[model samples]
Target chain A: GDKVKQSPSALSLQEGTNSALRCNFSIAATTVQWFLQNPRGSLINLFYLVPGTKENGRLKSAFDSKESYSTLHIRDAQLEDSGTYFCAAEEGQGGRALIFGTGTTVSVSP
Target chain B: NAGVIQTPRHKVTGKGQEATLWCEPISGHSAVFWYRQTIVQGLEFLTYFRNQAPIDDSGMPKERFSAQMPNQSHSTLKIQSTQPQDSAVYLCASSLQGEDEQYFGPGTRLTVL
Candidate 1:
C-alpha cells in the first residue's frame, strides 16, 4: 500500500500532442511537487503546488489537497518531454519530508 | 548557484564493504534531502535535514544506513555491509526551506557486488 499512487505507469504520445499525468495520495498532503527525470537520469523540477493550479509555458498543474490528488498536463508535447514524471507529497505536518509516487514513464515520439 | 553537488558520480563496492556518499547543498539553503532510485522502487526518500539538523529519516532502513548533516552546506550518507540489493542511484536535494521546491543533484550511481 503506497502512500502516494501514480496512474498510467507508462505513457506514449506524439510530438505536438497533449497528455496528462496524475497522482493520488492516501496521506493528508499539504503540498505537492512534480519532477521530470530525463533520459540521462537527472531529476528536473517541474512544479510545486499548494492546493491550486499553476501554469508554466506548455505545462499546467493542479493540486487539490482536500481531494488528495494532483495532475500534470503537458500541452504540445515535445521530444524533450520524453522522460519519467514523479509526484511527491508532503504529509500532515511532515516537516520537510516527502512521500514519492512510483512515477510515470512518458515517451514522446516525433 | 551550483544546484546541489554530489561527489563520486559512480561507485562500485564488494558485499560486506562500506560506502560513503557526500552532498553539498546550494549556498544558504536550509534544508537537504537524500533519496534512492531504482527501476522497481522508483524514487524513495531516505532522510532529510533542516538547518544542519536532522528532521526526518523515517524512510531509511533500520540497519546499516545512516545520514548526517554536519553543517548547512553539506551532508553525508553512509552504509555499512553493503549488499548487491543496495545498487541504485542516490540523489541529493536542497531547498531554501522545508516546504519549498527542491533542487536536485545529478546523483551518484552505486553498484554493490
Candidate 2:
C-alpha cells in the first residue's frame, strides 16, 4: 500500500479564490512537512507540523495525527501559487527519511 | 544563506556512460538527503547521510548507484552504466541534525539517451 496518499491529483484556482489540498497517511507518521514545487522544479518549504495547525501569510496547514491526515489551505490564491504541492511524512524518530505523497498539481490564473 | 548547491544543473549523457552529480549542503547542517523525481515516479528517496556517515540507503538501487558524503559540506551521487531509466531530477536536501524540516536544492536534471 502507498504509505502516503494525496487527494485531488490536480486542481485549478482563480486569483483571489481559495482551495485546500490533503494527504492521508497509512503509516504512523510522527511529523509531516509540506512543500511547493514550482514550475522551475525547485521545491520551496512551506510548513513543518507535528500536530495542530499553523498559519503563514495566506497559507494555513493543519496536521491531525490521530486521524492520520493533513490539510493545506490556500487563501486568496495568486499566480505564484501555481505549482505542485507535496506532503511528506516521517515515521518514528531518529534521522529517518521522509516518504512523500504523489502530490497535487495546482494552477492559478486570473 | 545560499541554501543547498547542485552542480551541472542539467546533464545529458549517453546510455552506458557514467554520470556524477554533486551536492553541497547548507553550512552547519548535519543531515543531507538525496531523492529522485520523475514524471512517472513522482519523488523517491535514494539515500541520506548524517554527519558524513550514511545512516540509510535502503531506497538506493542495489547496483549501479552509489552515494557518498566524504565530508559534511559536500556529497556525490554516481551512476555507473547509466540507462534511459535514470532520466530524472535528482534533489539534495539538508536539515539541522535530527530535525524533520529539510530544505531542498534546485535539483540536477539527468537525461540519459
Per-residue lDDT of candidate 1, residues A30-107 (tens digit):
989999988888989999998999999999999999888999999999998899999999887646677799999999
The C-alpha stretches of model 2 lying farther than 4 A from their native spots are: none
Worst 10 residues of 1 chain B by lDDT: B94-103
Any residue pairs clashing in model 2, and if so which?
A: none
Tens-digit lDDT track for model 2 on A1-110? 89999998999999999999999999999899999998899999999999889999999999999999999999999999999999999988776788999999999999
**Model 2, B1-113: lDDT tens per residue?**
99999998999999999999999999999999999999998899999999899999999999999999999889999999999999999999999994668999999999999
Clashing pairs in 1: none
For candidate 2, the per-residue lDDT at A89 reads 94
Docking class for model 1 is medium
Off by over 4 Å in 1: none
Against the true structure, what is model 2's DockQ?
0.82
lDDT of each: 0.92, 0.95
As for candidate 1, its interface RMSD to one decimal place is 1.6
